[model samples]
Target chain A: MTELLARLPETTAAHLGLSLAALTLGVAVAVPLGVMAARQPRLAGPLVGVASVLQTIPGLALLAFMVPVLAALGLTSIGVLPALLGLFLYSLLPVLRNTITGLAGVDPAVREAALGVGMTPRESLVQAELPLALPVILAGIRISATWTVGTATLATPVGAPSLGSYIFGGLQTRNYAAVLVGCAASAVLALMIDGLLRALALGLERRRRRVTTASLAGLLGLGAIGASPAVCTLGTRDEAPIVIGAKTFSESQILAQVLAGRITEQTGDAVRTVDSLGSTVVFDALEHGQIDAYVDYSGTLWTTVLGRGEPRPGRTELLDEVGRALAEERGVHVVAALGFENTWVLAMPRAQAERLSVRRLGDLAPHAPRLRMGGDYEIFQRAEWAALVTAYDLRFAEQRTLDPSLMYEAVRSGQVDLVAGLSTDGRLAALDLVVLEDDRAVMPPYDAVILASERLRRERPDVIAAMRRLAGTIDDATMRELNRRVTEAGESPAAAAAWFLGRPLPP
Target chain B: MIRLIDVTRRFGDRLAVDRVSLDVAEGESLVLIGGSGSGKTTTCKMINRLVEPSAGRVLVDGQDVAHQSGPRLRRRIGYVFQRLGLFPHMTVAENIGVTPRLLGWDADRVRVRVRELLELVELDADAVAERRPDSLSGGQAQRVAVARALAAAPPVLLMDEPFGALDPLTRERLQGSFERIRRELRLTVVFVTHDMIEAMRLGDRIAVMSDGRLVQVGTARQLYEAPVDATVRELFAAPRRQARLIESRLERGAP
Candidate 1:
């Protein structure tokens, strides 16, 4: 709870910046287009059809899709730009639809009156029809304002910071307090925005000066709050700080902090972190130079990227093979191994394991049919899961994909007999779970390696060299302790990384 | 003066106004009397270029209406619709002041004109100027609509059933007010109405239309005494008989 409060200012800024920017831009564009659509009957169907189609895309997928699409356009694929664009697209539908509806809904007699009063079409729209339709259009804006706030939370997974950081980070670390804080803040923000818009709508409807003044004042105050962070970010665009990314996990976040801290310390260069990226997104962003560097597990890249199902004889051999493959094929240079392995592992509660006498993966086959296995959403789709299932000949009665945060609790509470656990997860030790050994070596070494974009390698070799100072610096216990600080002690990854590096905390 | 030369307006395949030709003299109140769909409203609209004629020309003051921009031509001609389409979002004063302001009148001058029009329409300017249309009575709203149409003091006016939506008592009162105002302003007006009684009461000359063509154009007494056809005679027959019966009763000193 304290951690969430401490981080409130930055996250609140991000949440407001991205959501409000998108909304304002959305209205600016959609309203005029809507008016044009209303005027031009020939274009009305296509205009509305396109906006409706955009609305049908799921919010998360929409944000995710922006990363690569922006990259393809040779633009920044991470940070607030892509997020803003995605939310803008999402915010467009209601405003456009409502503008069209409200304008169309104006009484024909009233329109005649406008024309009869000698108002040009433009003047009629500006002075009479728009004012009359203000309430309805504002109602649409209010809907979009609330929706944008909620959808902005999904921006975190696309390398944009928002209130979703608390939710995504807290969920990954099993810290529900942070999630509650984020959800509550977003709901309050949404309500505040909606209330102001409602006031503006009422003012327009009744043409009351006092109501208009109060609502405009309220909206202006929020506008300042929302615009502040965005202004700051855009002002720094010329500097273009190196963007470091992390996937949605405590270790990933901690590793990103370590890299950022090291680069700042050694090279004295400006660095920015865009954390909570999805696994594939971070890699794609790096390749496109939207992000300069991020830490990835070798086994994950080998299987997911290379489509190689075969496991090598040893950890070093696998690492060497994958590292060479990445550099040769994709222009991604492996800076160094961070000397920690966070591989996938199967685990059960100690009591359940003892009761079933399950000491290894082979020993679980007999009981697998009666058991329900739980894992994170990606586990079922991974090659590691397939390899493990084939090696052990194991099939649970049901395989449920739970969030990473809930898997431990599910296994601990006897809701599930088994789970796919991360090797370095703090909860694996905290919950007294027994990890089954893989005798067949079906899973390859999952050494965490720092990978840099080819552009970064070519342009900033000094930064890479500085980052290599941390090669073999963190061992298994050290990595686990860092994770524990974030997941259990409520320490932010920045603070944990600073503590581990014996340096002052970031301002 | 306004003239429709072979003016024909078609909405799709249906001819709303078919080859109608008429010349309205200066300061003449030409009431277009017709049943529903009789093209009276279409003819009125053509004067302001609200609806362009498909096959002919509308001339205002010896100039082609199409030569001037639609909005510019409309600003020179006042238009009042049946429903009294006063802008609900604006106050009565603002509604009345709209065209004068559009003509670039200063605030003080626009305010004075709004007050003058309000009085001309028999409305209390002080009481109703700040009130919105929704707050006004139907008769009051119709008055404001007239005031709005008269704001810029256009020489030409086009009214389509301006008092059609009012109660009989209110309608008669408003008609009397309009008659006095029309005479005072010496305005050239093409007033459209379906009611023969209204046409007789308000029009200097009434142009009656049936279907999409002009049936007869004459004064009330002229049309009453000399019937163009039975339809035109039938239109005024009942009212003429009622008036004569009432006159006979008065002459005999009967209550």
Candidate 2:
């Protein structure tokens, strides 16, 4: 436990506690909403359904969705806006359900007597109904508290690191102990909440037994003494929040650093990041409010955003409309597309490419029947890859999508003949794989677009400006270097972002 | 004064109260004497608007009570059901202060009034006031209910078998306290009871009913002296005769 505590940042633990603090807030929100919904059965149907739906959305998807949505609205980790919002929405069902159930379960005669003695609906609720309902409501809160603590740990992946840093740090290093520590800490926090809330519920239960004010006061004093440690502080006066988010790949991390650096120039506020989520996840994050801003590829927005399986439109038209379509439908603003497209670029040994004369997909088609293809897992299923293969009608000897990390070994050992490398990948140069050019430009340009949540757009003009400054700045070489620092240099994201932010990209 | 006029209550197809009416004059304790389902509790609830009349109006101070909202109406009409319904969350004094507190009485005034009501119910003012309803005996809790009912000094009070749960000794003691307090307050009270002896002991005037209809209305002495019908006469005579029968049954074939 001591080693675990020592490894985890105090900053991370503090955010974890504060974010879960919203469990109480969620209970406060849920109880009244639940009560109102209960009183009017018609409202309960839709309102309760909404809370359930919110919980069903996967945590990663929801966090990514909220990022740009909040960036547009200009809220972040500093405001605790998205974290509070997501947790609140998540916690509503249990507290609300319990409140309604508890109130419904109270003896009718007791309720009647309360009303019969001049208790207004409000007074009757506070004096009679709420006291009775508290135990049930608190039980629901216990569930939400456990769930919220568990989910908030994922906030670390999205620049909202609470205790989740331990889990992610473990994932990065393949150390299960780190994940266990995170889970254990969260469970401990949840147990603490359960104990305190149960004590509160029991004290309220025992309130009648201690009729004297002095006894009640003593109980309250003891509770106050007990609660002081669990409270987690949020926001420093000096470092304000600049919101940043990232797409799935390495280059997106570089762009996030670019944005984070630019924002620091304006307000001297430290950036809050939700980084390295899936392409779709990042898009949704911006839409909901988890991330303030993130980088995305033009090709992804074309097919993924438009909901088309194969790329129907050509490269330039797709790129042009990508911005317009995302803004119109998703409320995502694509400020500017950067210079490079990290599109699928098939490569192999230089001798192999030359001997086959495989300059393009069509050029490689005749030889493909005998060649085995190896690439990242996602490229095989991507629309760009699918369309190119179908267009050329090339059938390789065998196609295998390997993890990007294992690609060099797979190619060097001749486990596969061809490499489906990304255009800006540093490994293509480092491993000396021949990058076969796509003569037909079949793959749409995978350019970066700056996104903002509607909240961030209305609220933080400075953050948008800081990110807009990064538009047209990153090219293939610059981003490759940024990735090299992160992957090869063994530098952490914060240090990597700091170094990259200090050094301006060449125009 | 409390008055019910031509009240008729229906529970599904059953006639719980069928055009029955009566008056509870100030300083007069009027208990409705009835069997189960004879509309005695229904009539009492109508005064505080707990159970609304299906057909006629109840009047308190000759003003229509049906128009008063539940909370506003109940404060002026003190009511205690057969089950007591003392808030399990509150102490005896706190339960007593419920009405006065709802009426916006200051803390000091409400506390003083609560103490007086507990004393009126023959409770030790200091000792019993802070005790929880759960901790109290059935009889003591019933007394607390009576104290709570009279806390705001409502001129019109209604009770549905308030001492119905207690044992004989505690029930009689509470009945005596209520009688003496009723004398001192000169309050209009509508009490419900199926117990003929209890009705005779507590009521100045007794309204006897059967099958939801009023069979007779008269002073306690008049009820025993001359009832309106055979059923009314039997209702008055049965309790006194039952006591004698029980006494005889206990002595039957004994040494």
Candidate 3:
């Protein structure tokens, strides 16, 4: 219990730091921007219009959007900055709008009186205007703080550590305890910050002044002190199936969903992942024994997933070689590769490529550094990309790695000169990012494979066979268009998966 | 010494204060008396430039009020009000210290000044300095308001009916206090009020107005003794006498 409590503080600190930083950063950017806008009426409307538009974008899409942008900038830390940027954007309206509203609402008489007193504009604002406007300004701060804390929970998707981890991870793995802890802690944090700030507001009103923000600091400190007693008891239960987990892309989620889904279906037993796992988090969880099994790609297994050295080989031979090596090396098993090839193919704008006379990977090597490269999340970071770059000496002025769904748009928008896109993703055709042939053969086959904990093979061969039913059946053309409809056409992945399994297309 | 030269203040076509000229010499207290909407308040406010005249100019000690900007101008001119618009945020001392602080008085000077002003207003400085405006009594707040206006010893004080809201007893007490303060400070005061008795008691000189136009201007005795027109005779000094007679002798006759 003491150990658990100790860990709890660190966890809570992480959440608070992320949430507060998000709130502060949001206020820092938005208030000044809003002030500028309000002063220039023409600017204020459109500036806020842009912020409101940001809020209108879905939370998941926005976080996903930050992944490649931040990753390209080399900011792939598994915590606050990613989440903070998103929450900061989320917190803008309350602070920005309220600041403008509060300051604007000050009576004209008071402003004139302040000015009349020979106060410099800055002095007048502090002594006369802001004092009168304090109640309203404090109101904005309270709202922004509460909002940032709440929204930062969603950062768990992009490998951020927060309360949402419990909810999403628990949902994935069926671990209600971890979910309960995550949720309960976050609620307390939001409530605590809200209460303390409210007290400060009330105290200032009656006394007509403020002291140090000690009241808020005290609560945050107390929360830390209170969190110290729970860390030890949860002691590296990291070995339990409930402990280790991973989140890759949709395929990883679907594979985890299918495995966990069928495990409960057949045996009437449930084990939930403690937190929702993202791409890097899944590997970390595997290394920490924080999760038991996850489904990743064979080519990813060769390059990124396993961090293997590059080799010159064909699709089938390379996959086989990588699969054999991983079993020998990592003490992990490839139960099966789903009936599909999730290969990374460099795509270009069809018309643009034709016009440029660029036909293949080697054909465009000279222009590589000058062109823009767009690809999926893992592909840009993979050895396959490096080998392709090294083999063809490919370089581009800009490189963008995006979600498989957005690969086409990156090319469509002319934002990228080349895209390392999935061979089977349907978005390639829909958005017109043409697949340039990899004539140099530097890339390997990426068969969708379900890698599991060795403990699982000794225990559950039935689960393996059930998953193998999906092995090597989904072909490039059939799978490509299906994936496109789900991502690009906005259909559900579960519905898409159901349709894929309904066919006898797998060999 | 505050003077308004042919001041015409118009609010979107209605002449709030028409081209009226008035002068308040140093050490002289002038009272502007009229019913509401007669521009009594507007004329006093013009001396401070609170209400800018649509045409014409006001001068304080020969310096144009329009040109005298910033704390230098404000520090030299004090303003009081009937309701005593004391800021709710600051304590009594802080409110009283506004003008001094604005004039860049040192902290020690402000302390001493605030203490002396509180003493002059008959408030215990120590008790009131830490207390907020809302916590102070109405009479107390008003005294603090007077102290605030007098803090920097502005040569000219424009008061808009400073005692209009007080009870008659409190009004009489404050009037006595003001007379003493006026002699010691030698301030050029412009007081606005509708109460004829208050004007007679407080003002050395009186200016009466009707419909945004000045009807009469003279010493209080001169206005009362001569009363150039029937309106002046009926309105200025008779209202109080009528109230007294009607309440006593006429009460039994009416019954």
Count clashes in each candidate, considering only residues at least 3 apart in sequence or on different chains: 0, 35, 36
DockQ of every candidate structure: 0.74, 0.51, 0.21
Give the candidate number with the greatest DockQ. Answer: 1
**For candidate 3, lDDT tens digit of each residue in A1-507?**
233345566667677767776776787887777566655778878887888888787775566566555655666433345666777788888777776777687766556555444455667667876677677767887887787677767887755666676556443333456558778888888888887777777777776244335665665675554333233324633333332244634444444545555455445555554334566555544433334566677667767756766554666776677677767876677767666777778778788789888878778877776787776656666667778788888778887767544555567777776677667666567667677787866777777776666666667676556555656655667666665644555444445555654555435
Q: Candidate 1 - CAPRI tier? A: medium
- Give the winner by TM-score: 1
Q: How far off is residue A162 in model 2, in Å?
A: 4.0
Compared with the true structure, what per-residue lDDT tens digits does model 3 show for residues B153-253?
88778788878888888888888988889888888888899888888878899998888888889997788798888757776547777788888877678
Model 2: docking quality category: medium
In the order shown, the candidates' Cα RMSDs to the true structure are: 3.4, 7.5, 15.1
Model 1 has how many clashing residue pairs?
A: 0
Off by over 4 Å in 2: A1-25, A41-46, A62-82, A154-161, A165-189, A208-245, A248-251, A258-274, A277-302, A305-490, A494-507, B11-14, B67-70, B224-226, B244-248
What TM-score quantifies how close candidate 1 is to the native fold? 0.93
lDDT (0-100) at residue B97 of candidate 1?
Answer: 93
lDDT of each: 0.89, 0.73, 0.70
Question: Which parts of model 1 are misplaced by more than 4 Å?
Answer: A1-4, A231-242, A264-271, A310-314, A354-357, A362-369, A386-395, A502-507, B241-255
